[model samples]
Target: MSQTETNRRLITELQSRGLRLLDESAGAPSRRGGAGPSDHKAVQINGQTVMVPVHSRSAAVSPFEAGASGANGAVQLTRDGAHVGDIRFPEAPRFYGLQTLDGVPYWKIAQLHGTDVLATTVLQTCVRYGRRDTSCQFCAIGESLAAGRTINRKLPEHLAEVARAAVRMDGVRHMVMTTGTPNFTDRGAALLCESAFAVRAAVDIPIQAQCEPPDDPVWFDRLKAAGVDSLGMHLEAVTPEVRARIMPGKAEADVEQYMAAFADAVAVFGRGQVSTYILAGLGDSASAILETSERLIALGVYPFVVPFVPVGGTPLAEHPPPDAAFMRSILQPLGRMLAEAGLRARDIKAGCGRCGACSSLSTYED
Candidate 1:
């Protein structure tokens, strides 16, 4: 295979099966349980940093394992006991060591994602998270909060402080501010606005704010005015049946509602600036995912389709991740669709898709 295809295949398999670290010291500090990309550590392979699951059940028995660290922390990757290639872990960000004047640690407010993107959940508690019946089966939004690794609510100013420090100390390129849906008509848009406004005022960092579609479409304009460079309204599942089965409460908004919101959002954020998260293995057929992605691309929405990683401590913790073949079936075609529509993830100002670390879809976008 060509180099790009080789890297794409390797990343897809690693994300699906997870990576087992044979030498504990070989890897950098990984995100344990948090809002985005939990149970993963950022691994740079062939100059691309992608989040690889290292703490999931599948990881413990993964055929792909990393051996002892070499110079500059590069480790040998072996698949089925055969050496594959070398990968390196991103070192912990310097901002992780600082704290707010009130004694809140900076790391809790915003943690490093992949190599340089700073990420955090502005509101750690979700209205639906407390109940299994209402929550997304794959979510672990409350795990970090319950474990005391992060606070319940990150005040706007506090988030700003950390964002500024992260930029200055670690050269953080962009910021991702997601929220647990709040119990309001605006969902969590108001909180994200406040947080994004503060961060923008504090620094010149590009920001992407993610939340459920607000009750009013005007909030999209408000979000753009607040310095949110990009917008994400995630449709974790596409079809009605899968939406209700996987994320019952969020499904109430429905795919139709999200489509309307995406149109409104695209008007404000421009093409490729508005995006959505699509989990590929959540009972949605590969054709269903590609069909949805085609619609999204037509509407200027980037469908960031990622293989679902079953995070520990959630309802789907033991659920099997989508195998590499299934993911390849979805991503390979979706990447072409994205290219045809001129909706490249790299063109996205900021967000999960722009980061392109959670999934190997970006690798196939060429």
Candidate 2:
């Protein structure tokens, strides 16, 4: 295989099967139980930072394992006991040590994703998360909060303070502010707008705000006016049956609602700035995912398809992530479709799709 193809396959395999570290200290702190990057760790392979499953059940028995770290901090990786190559873990962000004036730790308010992308959950509490029947089976959004690792609600001022420090001390390039769905008609858009406005005022970093589609389309303009450069309204599953079965509460929004919202968001954020996350391992088939990606691309929305690695405490904790073959079937074609549509992750200003760390689809775009 060519070098590019090798990297693509390697990344896909690592994400699907996960990587087990012989010594936990060799890897950076693995994020466990949170709104984003849950049960995973950021690993830099071939100079590309990707989030791989390191705490999932699959990882415990994964064929790939990281051995001892070299003098230069590079760790040797072995697949099924045979050495594959060396990989490095990102140093913990320097801003993590700072605290707000009110005595809250900065790390609890916002966390770093990938190498330089700073991310935070504006509102950790969600209306649907309180009930098992209404919750997304794959979600562990409440885990971090219950463990006292994060505050239920992050004040806008605290967010601004932490964001500024992250940019100044760690050289963070962009910020992603996502919120749990709130009960109001505006959903979490209102909170996101308030939070994004504060962060933008404190620092000039680009921001991506994520929330469920609001009841009214006018909120798109409101979000743009608040200095949000990108928007993400995720559609975790494409097929209605799968959505309803997997996430009964979120499925209530329906595909039609998401489609309309995507159009409105694209108009405000521009073509490539509007994006949605589509987890591939859920019940949706590869064909179903590709169909959704095609329609999303036509609507000027970037569909970020990533493997669904189960979180430790979620209902689907034991559920197996999509195998490498299954993921490649969806991502390879989806990457071509994105390139043909003139949509690329590198062009995105800020967001999960732009970070492209949780998925290898970005590699296939070439």
Candidate 3:
């Protein structure tokens, strides 16, 4: 196979099958405190950073696992004991050890994501998380907070302090500040604007802020004026049936509302700068995903298609991730659609889709 094809297949397999760490690699940094699966470990394979599940069910008997023996700090990746490739683990960031003047660890404020981006949940608590019917079934947003790995709410100044330190100590390229929905007319836009403003004053890094569509479209302009370079209003699942089933409370916002918000957001943030995340395995058909992608691209919103990974503690913990073939079916054409529309992730100013490590769509972009 060609190099691009090889990479695309390898990434899909790794994400689908997960991987097992050997005894020699016991000390590799593993994700413990954050949203989504806390069981993931970031590994660099084929010169790309990909987060793989190492502590989930799929990992226990994954066909691909790191070999016990290797030399020169390189580990051999094998599928059923046959050599597949080589992979390396990324070390923990230098900023993790540092603390603010008040003694809170810098990592608690923001953690390194992909290779060079810093990401954090500005408000760790979600209003819907209190009730089972209203919560996003796959969300683990509060798990990190309950474990004391993150603070419940990050003060704007603390976020600014952490952003400055991350850039200076580890060369963080950009920052992603996402929040659980707070009870306000602005729907968390107010806090994100305040936080982004503080960070911009402290550092020169680009920032992407994510939240639901606010009650008023004018919040988009306010967000732009606050130094947010990009905006993300994640749809997660496109079809109303899947959306209601997966994220009941969130789905109440309705796709029409999201579309309206995307239009206004694109006006403020520009075409490729506004994006939405669409999880491919959430019961949305491939055709459904492509249909939504076409509409989103038409509105100047980049559709970030990612494979669904089940977080361990959520209601859907036993739910399986989308098969690799299923993901390929959506991403391949979606990549072409994005290319045709001139909406490549590289054009995005900052955020998860730009990081593109958790998903392999970027590898397929032409």
Candidate 4:
């Protein structure tokens, strides 16, 4: 197979089946702190960075596993003991070991996503998490806070300190700051604006700020003025029924509100700079996802369609991940749609879509 085809196939497999570590002593840098599926490990295969679930039940029985024996810091990827390819585990970032003046670990404030983009949830507490009927079934935003792996709320000053360290020590090119919705009309936009300002003041890096649509559309301009290069308003499920079933409270910000918000955000951040995350497996059919992608693309919103990984400790922990075939069916056409519309991830200034590590859509953006 061609290298590109091989990579596409491998990414589909890894994201769907996860990866098993045959040797725990292989010295791979496992995830130590973060929200949602804290057991993932970053691995590079065929020049693409992917987060593979290593501690999930599916991974324990996954056909794919990494063998310890290798050269040049590379390991062998195998399926049922048959060689597939060579994979390399990324080393932990230097910033992970550093601490703030108050003695808080830098890693607890922000963690590396994909290869070099630093990511953090600014507000760990969510208004919806208090009630099972309202919480997003796939969310584990509070898991890290509960485990004491991260602070409940990251102060702007501390975030600035960490951003400076991460950029200086690890060559982090960009940053993604997402926040759990607080019980404010601004829906965490105000805090994101403050945090974005601090990070930009400390480093020259581009940043993406994610939150639900605020009560006021003017916050989009405020975020842009605060040095936020991109904006993300995630609609994890495209259909209202699926959304209501999967993320009850979040679904209250109906499709119409999100559409309005996306329009407002795009006006400030510009077309490709605004994006939304669409998780493809919570019972949204490929047709529904594609139709929604069309609408988002029309509004200049880059649809970052990703496979649903059942996060541990969440209500959906036992829910199976989308099948590899199912994901490819969605991504292949969705990638083509993005390419034709000139809404490629590379065109995104900075954000999850631009990072494009969690999904294999970028590979199919031919």
Candidate 1: the clashing residue pairs are none
Candidate 1 TM-score, true structure as reference: 0.98
RMSD of each: 1.0, 0.8, 1.6, 1.5
lDDT of 3 at 194: 96
Residues 1-366 of candidate 3 have per-residue lDDT tens digits of 898799889998888878888853443367763663367878788788877878767778799888654566567899999998888776678989899999999888888887789988889888898898999998888888888888988999999998998899889999999998887478899999999999999999999999999999999999999999999999999999999999999999889889999999998899899999888787999999999999999999999888887777789878888888998998899999989888999989899888988888898786
Superposing every Cα of model 3 onto the true structure, what RMSD results?
1.6
Q: Which stretches of candidate 3 lie over 4 Å from their true place?
A: 23-28, 68-71
Residue-level lDDT of model 2, residues 239-354, one tens digit each, is 99999999999999899889999998998889999999999988899999999899999999999999999998889998999999999999999999999999999999999989
Tens digit of lDDT per residue, candidate 1, span 1-366? 798889899999999999998776554578778789999989999899999999999999999999888877789999999999999988788888889999999888888998879998999989998898999899998898889889989999999999888889989999999999997599999999889999999999999999999999999989988999999999999999999999988899889989999999999999999999999888999999999889999999999999999998998999899999999999999988888888898998898999999999988889
**Candidate 4 stretches greater than 4 Å from native:** 24-28, 32-38, 69-71
Q: Cα miss at 126, model 1 (Å)?
A: 0.6
Task: State which candidate, 1 or 4, has the greater TM-score.
Answer: 1
Q: After superposition, how far is residue 219 of candidate 1 from its true place, in Å?
A: 0.7
Q: What are the models' TM-scores? A: 0.98, 0.99, 0.96, 0.97
Error of 4 at 356 (Å): 0.9
Residue-wise C-alpha lDDT for candidate 4, range 194-240, written one tens digit per residue:
99999899889999999999999999999999999999999999888
